[model samples]
Target: MKYIAPPRDAVDPQVFSRMPLAAWRDHAGLIEGRDWPSIEALNAHLPAAARECFVAQTRELLADGLHYERRIAERGEIATRERNWHDLFNALVWLRHPALKRALNARQAAEVARMGPKTRSRAQCALTHFDEAGVIVVASDPALIAPWDAHDWHRLFWRERTAWQDGRAQLEVFGHALLEHALTPGKLLVGKALVFHSTQAMEVVLAHAAAAIAHGELLCDPLELRPLPLSGLPGWHPHSDDEAFHRHAACYQPRRTGRSYPPAVRLGHLGRAALV
Candidate 1:
C-alpha cells in the first residue's frame, strides 16, 4: 500500500506534541506555525558547516545520473520535495543531528562507490534501514538492556517502565521516515535501534555513535540493530499503560528462532569501549 500524506492544511499541528516529535518541538515549530517552507527556508536552518543544501527535487535534477547518496556526497545537494512531510522531517533531522547525518552520508557514499548503484550490500541495507527508521536507545544502566536482548516486552516495558521517565533510558528518534509516519494519529511506531550502555551525556554518546559509523565500526550489518516498539514506551501509546498491552499487542512480537543481537555499545569515562 502506498502512503498518502495528510493534507498540509488538514494536519493538526498538535499532533507533534507527543514523544519523539515533542523532543523535536523547537524545530517543528519553525515550519508548523506558518505556510510550508520553501527550499530557501530549509537551507537557512542548516549549520554553517553543513555543506549539503536541501534543493528542490525537479525533473531536471532527477535527469542527472548521480545516485541520491552520490548527489549529497559529490554535489552536496539533498533533493527535497515541496510540501512533503518526509522531506520536511528530514530537514529537521539535519538541523538537529548534523554530525550523525553527515556520518551516515559518508558511509552511504562509500558503499555506493564500492558496490555500484545496481546492488546493495548488507552494510548498505543496514545503513538505509537506520536512515529511514532508526533510534538511538541509550541506557545509563546496562541492566536495563537485558530484557530487550531477551525480547521480554513485558519486563522491559512494564516492569522497568519508570526507567524511561527517570532518564536511565532514552529513545532518541533519528529517522525522518519514522517522524513522517508519526503524522498518522495513534500510530504504533517501531524503531530500528542501536543500543548504547553509556554513563556519559547524550551529546557524548551521539559523538561516539557518529564516529563509529564514519569509522566503519558500527551499523555494519542489519542484525546489529534491535527492533524497538516505540509505543511500548510510557505515554507514547494509549494502550501501553496497561500491562496486558505488552503481552498481546500486535506490535509486540516474540523473539524469532536463531535470532541474536550484538552487545550494546559501551561508553564510559574511558571513552567508547568494546561492545558488552
Candidate 2:
C-alpha cells in the first residue's frame, strides 16, 4: 500500500499491524464450527451449543430475524434492531465471530431492557455508543494514549506513514458491534486513525468480499474522519434532528478517561486477522 500526503510533505512516521476479516472468517479452528452455507443460510449455522445461545438471543433482539441482506439490499439500511452483516465481504463479520456477536447482542439487549428502550440515559447512550463503536485501535506502546486521546488524526494518518506497515498499529473497524460488547466498556474511546483499517478490508484478505467495500477509504480523511457524535453514527438520526457532520466531536483527555484506551477489544486475542 502507498501512503501519499496530498499537497506534498510527510509527517512523523509510525508502524501498525492489522488482521483482515478474512483471517478471522477463514481461520481453520475459528471457522470449523462457525461457517454458514450462505446469507440465506444464517438459520442453519453450524451445530454448536453456543450457536443455540446466539440464535435464541438474536431472535429476541431482532424480532424479524437477521435477514441482513434482504433488509440491506431492498432498502440499504442495516436494521438497528437485531440484524447485522456477512453476505458481503464486510457482512462476513457475523459468520466470523459468532461468540463475540452473541455477547454483544446480549449486552445491547440487556441495556435496552433495563433502560426501557426509549430512555436515552447516559449509561444507555454509552452502551449504544460503545455497542456501535466505529474503531478498535491497538498500538505497540501505551504511551500513544496521550496522542490518541488528543484526537490526533492528521498526524496518525498522513504524517505517520509507516505506522501500520511496521506493526506498531493494528485496527479492527468492521467488528465494532462484536468487539464493543465482547469486552468491557468505559471511558471516552479515541483512536489514531492514520493507522486505522476499516471492516471493508476483509475483501483483500478473503479474495471474495463483495465489491461494495473492496476499495480502501482512508481513516484520516479530514472530511470523513470527524469525531462521531455520542448519540450515533453519521447519517443515523433515530430520534430526530439534522446534524449533518460530526458536530459534537469532543477531544478526550487524561482528565476525563484513563491514558490508555482501546481496552474493549483485547488486542492479543482479536488481532489474528493477518492472512499471512
Candidate 3:
C-alpha cells in the first residue's frame, strides 16, 4: 500500500488542547516518524533530544508501557501459538522423518517425548510459567521486541524470530490512526514508513483467513492488551447518555425564557418570578 504523508502543519490546536497523557504516549511513534532520519543521516537532521525521545518512547511502547500493547497482545499471542505448533512439528519431524530419525539417538528421542503434547493446556502452562518468570520474556514496546539481555541472543537461536518481527509489523499498522491524528505536531515525517508498513500488515491479515484467525486470537486474549471503546470523547455519539452531559458540565445552566427547560427548572423560575 502507498504511504500517506501527514500534512506539514499536522498539529490540530483543538486536539492538542484536549490531549491526554494516553494520547501523547500512544502517538509517540507518529511524532518520531515526523523527524526520523536514516542511521547514516541520523547525525545531521535529527537532534539529540528528538532522538532521545524517539528511542525512549519506542522502547516504552515496545515494553508494553505505551499503546503498542494491543499490537503486542495480538501479535504475541498468535506468534506464541505458531511457535508452539512449530515446536510440535519439529518434534514430529524428528520422530517421523526418515532422515531426521536416523540422525537422532535414543536419548534425543526420549528428550523429545519429555517435551510432550502441544495441546492448549500444556502450551498455556508453559507460556504462562515462562512469561511470569522466564529469563527471556518477549516484551511489546512500540515497534520493536528485542531480548532484555543483548548477550543472550543465542537462547532463542532455535526459536522463530520472525514471529516477533511479524507481530511488530502488525502493531505498527494498528497504530496508524493514532499516529496520523495525534503524534506529529508541526510537520509529519519520521516514522511514516513504519506506519505505512504496519498498515500493510493489517491488510495482509484481512486478506487471509489463517492470518486473521491468528491476529484475532491475539486480540481476544484477556492477558494481553484489551481494546478500549472510543465512546467517551466528543463526536463519538455514545450509545447511551444515562448520565447526561449537562449534569457534569460546570457551566451548564437552564434557560428561564424557554419551555424547553426541565420541569424542575421551570418550577424554580416560576417561584422566583412570583416572589419578585
Cα lDDT computed for each candidate against the true fold: 0.85, 0.33, 0.26
Lowest summed lDDT window (length 10), candidate 1: 267-276
- Using TM-score as the measure, the top candidate is 1
lDDT of 1 by residue, 1-276 (tens): 666768777776766787767788677645566578889988888877778899999999999988988999999999998988888988888888888898899999999999999999999999989999999988987887789888898999899999998999976899988888877777788899999887667877888888888778888999999999998999888788888888888878888998999888775422342222
Per-prediction count of colliding residue pairs?
A: 0, 16, 14
Model 3, 56-124: lDDT tens digits are 224434565322222322332111111121222222222222221221222222323455323233333
Q: Give lDDT: candidate 3, residue 195.
A: 14
Best by lDDT: 1
Q: Give candidate 1's error at residue 18 in angstroms.
A: 1.0
Error (Å) of candidate 2 at residue 229 is: 13
Show where candidate 3 strays beyond 4 Å. Answer: 1-5, 20-176, 183-227, 231-276
Estimate the TM-score of every prediction: 0.93, 0.40, 0.20
Better of 2 and 3 by lDDT: 2
Off by over 4 Å in 1: 30-34, 268-276
